[model samples]
Target: MNTPHTIVETTLVPHTAFEEATQRLEQCFSYADGASEPICIALVGESRTGKSRALEECFTRHAPIRQPDGLTTPILRVKTPSKPTVKSLAELMLRALADPRAYSGTENAKTSRLLKLMNESGVKMVMIDEFQHFYDKGSHKVMHHVADWLKVLVDDARVALVVAGLPTCRAVIDQNEQLAGRFLSPVFMPRFDWQDTDQREEFIAILGAFQESMGEAFDLPAFTGDEMAFRFYCATGGLIGYLTKFLRQAVWNAIDAKTTTIDLANLLRAHSEAIWAKDGPTGLPSPFDRRFSTAATDDLLARIKRIGIPAEEIRLPRSKAARQTGALGVQAVLTAR
Candidate 1:
């Protein structure tokens, strides 16, 4: 019998796109003080595409500085509210700074306090995650007022801003001409493409890393195997986040069933219970089935593409959204710098 020495912690593999985006963000942060105008960058992608994970990694590298009098934060990261307004955004920052009176103020008063606190704290760069909330995707309405407020804040504060969220968030900035001009071209985090030769190679390399990390969790099917890799590509639709999840669940199933090695049955069980249950039953063919064909692959890919649309416009199974939020906790755990 074999068992893992340790559970798989949320592993952050610095893929190429993630590294490039981080470099761009670092440049923006470093350039803020000397530049005449404020620098802004956006990390846009679909959910589970590792945008938030990349930002979290960058944030940890530039952690707040502790001084004798008070803390001086060189980089401040805050989560945007689902319904973001000047007041709610202010409260988020205040709370992140550990201000005692985070919630007690009018919108104007809150904005004033936020700016004063930011300046006094010596914050040079601000990172806002889940920025898709800036617009009402369901209503197809842009929150132009909030966008205006953010533009003014950035100008007055003279700090660089890094915003990351689903691609829909791009509309929020695009709707405001000043913001559109200020935000440099967005860095997109894309999912794995099965059809691309290079992507397939890189993805297998990623899987190899996972195999190593699993230690003795039970021999996972070799990702290099043509059939095995195809099954994995089908199961996860090229989202590294989903790939980790499916593998994790399969390991757990093996453990509970006292199985010596993971097999096709274990994977199918995990897929239905862990991935499909939440992702909704779309009548997609199971990769484990003997009859599974390229037609099934095409259908699955189409569904994955639909998920990249604006968050509100896309309808998800209730459990799916909840599960996504839960999975984020694993991603939030930062790896070593």
Candidate 2:
């Protein structure tokens, strides 16, 4: 297990889209307190495209700046439950509202209580991440009801809803005309494209900043930002979560080995397990991680390396391999003629 020597400062950077979205959200408040509603903007994208993190930060900034009741509590942290719906969604609002009756009422009562709470709290916007789970209730009836329920609550409270999720989330909301109407803007989170020079530069800067934030215990040296960013691009195709996990794990693995340097070797080893490993450092972790073998992990890593490609992708085999690091735990090299 690798432990990160340095911590990462995730707050300093602001993704462009998130900044724009926040500005639009702030304007939603100018509408009548009870009559104006937020124009729902569906934040759709592939997994790990920086959508969730960006939205969270933007929303937190927009929330009322009041301190929470407890010294430890921070006001304006939006709530997202394991299972979301009209009733459960209501409970989340109640909890956000700190309403004691949050648990006292039946499901409908809870929903009603939350709408009342929303209006009282002046919550102009409600954002739901992982909005796709709404369709997973094992029945379409529940899905439709959840949509209708959201419509009613939003209409009643006159607040905007920002739903962030995979593309499938749009389909769910599309079923509700009113819900779809509320969504005037559809923001898409595209994977970081190395093809764009400007995006690539920003990406590298973020990596450098992350390294600095992690501090000296992190073995990663300050190199030309572009070099570090390009290296990660090859490994992860600029997948945000994958890139984050790989970097953090590389530092952690370096720490575990009592090493003071994070090089290609350490990065590759950590990258393999932290991302493609069944344990999945960040993504929906594979259940098999706890029971799988190194070979299984290797296969998964290779497969990820194979996506969007046919059987033609070259695999660097062990027989022609140059060397291996035991703690890094994986080794493969592309062959030269």
Candidate 3:
């Protein structure tokens, strides 16, 4: 029997966007095998759009194997370190390859070792997550050397490369012409938009799937009914991550209360504690509140759209005076030296 806790924690409902992304990743893996030139792809999305999950799903499909001589990793996945430099990025790849001297080698040494290991381990595809780290948020500059190094590494290794990150990470590729040319059409995982008819129906169906899962464990209300589904969409801003979080919290609440069923009250409690606590105040009424209006007003929709989207990139001032001032600072330091 599926317990509420287990069902909520372990279930991964595959939605349309997630399925499409995973399929593309699998295609990339197959195309890279024995290909004359390396295949490269970029997976870009906002946080919680299931980018990492899709990468993970594809990685599981190409699980590493152990032979008498050593381990053979078909796919190597590494997270890009924050504010990555070539040295740091190389070290990370080395560590993923299980190099004992991952931290000790010089950048060039590490790169050589990394390539050798990839060949020995039979690495066909490399998956890099958090690729936005290649673009420094503070300085608004792409780490060109790191991007260049990665491009060369994939080319030399003759392996497919899949880099997944926030939408801002696109700057890393856009700024590097060589890197840009090597990539396929980028795969995008976007949040579910309630305004779109197809997306709205898909979101409702996703809710129905969750409700069915929960129903197996406990008595569940008609969570997929029109009003309830709309409420859930409002609460989660149509992001599957937020919906899962909200549902998990509600399940936990039910278990804590020694209840065998979930109701709107449980959802209301979950909304107040789980969604608002992490996302901050949205000035909107609780979607689960019985008295709350379910009408989809334009004003309401506009505010909901901002729920899970990341803040806009910081725009650094670009002016002749600013450049001159920066140059003067560098010149003053150089003169002091």
Candidate 4:
């Protein structure tokens, strides 16, 4: 029997952008072998746009195989360490390859060991996530030396490289001429936009898929209708991560409350508990609130629109922001009209 938790956690609602990104990754993995030059790809997107998930799905298809000699790791995946240096990165890669002395080696020694292990483990493609870490957050500078090292490493190992991270990470490749020249066209995973007709429809379809999944366990309020879908968009800003977080919370809430159906009241409570912490409140009205008006909703959507791609520039509207002044200010701005 599948619990609501299992249903929500396991269900991956396919949308257009996500599907396209997956296809691109598959193509990269498939053609990695028998290529003269090292194949490279960049998967860049804002946080919570499913960049990591897409990589994981592709990784699953090429699972590691165990043979008489040793385990064959076809694809090596590692997250970039915060404030990554060449030494730290080499060590991290060694650790992923199960090196006993991953932290004990000198930089050159680690690099040598990494290459040997890559050959030994049969690693053909290297996938690095959280690649934005290559950019210094405080100084706003790209780690050029490290990027250069990676370029050389890929070239020497003769393995395909895929780096996934925030859109800002594009600078990591763009700034390095050698690296940029080696990469195929970048793959972008962006949040759904309400203003775009196709995106809006896809967002609704995603909600419908989630609703169907949850419906298997408990009756969920209609989430596919335009008006209701718009409300959900306001709540999650059309980011699949936020939407899944919100729905996961609703599922748990339903279980705890001993309810068979997730109603608007349940969603209101879930929004409060899941979307934002009680400590910090955004002044904005809860999209799930019965009293939340169209004007307020539009006001919220407008604010979300301002959060353009490369979401780092303007942080997503948080509950804390809502608790402070924006919520009341939005109401004040709306009420005056």
**Top candidate by TM-score:** 3
Cα deviation in Å at residue 131, candidate 2?
0.9
The weakest ten consecutive residues by lDDT in model 4 span 305-314
lDDT of 3 by residue, 1-337 (tens): 5666878756777888899889888998998978878888888887878899889889988898989999999999999987788888888888888989999878888899999999999999999999999898788899988888899999999999999999989999999999998888999988888789999988898888888888887788897788888898888877777888888998888899998888888899888888655353256568898877889888887777777766677778789998999999999999999
**Higher-scoring candidate on TM-score, 2 or 3:** 3
TM-score of 1: 0.82
lDDT of 4 by residue, 1-337 (tens): 5677777778987777788888988888888888898999988888778899999988889878999998899999999999999999998888888889999878888999999999999998999999999998778799999999999998889999999999889988988999999999988888888988999999999989888889998987799987789788877777888788878899888888888799998888887787544212257677788876645355566676543233245566678856778779989989999
Q: What TM-score does structure 2 among the candidates reach?
A: 0.69
lDDT of 2 by residue, 1-337 (tens): 2125435324245556555655655555345355555456677877777677766666666555444632221122344454565667777667777888776778788877776666556566677777877665345433777778878777776666677777777777777787777777777776556667777776776666666665555555563355445555555655666667666677677768887787656666776767543323334223222232223244454444432222344667654234445323442332321
Error of 2 at 144 (Å): 1.3
What TM-score do all the candidates reach, one by one? 0.82, 0.69, 0.89, 0.87
Strongest candidate by lDDT = 3
RMSD of candidate 2 to true structure, Å: 14.7
Q: How many clashing pairs does model 4 include?
A: 11
The digit string of per-residue lDDT tens for model 1 on 1-337 reads 3234234445566777778888998899888996788899999887778888788788888888889989888887999888888888889898887788999999988888888988888888889999989889668898888889888988989999999988889989888888999989999988888778888888887877777766455776676577777767777777876777777787777778887587777778787776644353256566665566645366666775453233344565669778898778667765321
Worst 10 residues of 3 by lDDT: 276-285
User: Candidate 2 at 219: error in angstroms?
Assistant: 4.7
Sort every candidate by TM-score, greatest first: 3, 4, 1, 2
Residue 238 local lDDT, model 4: 72
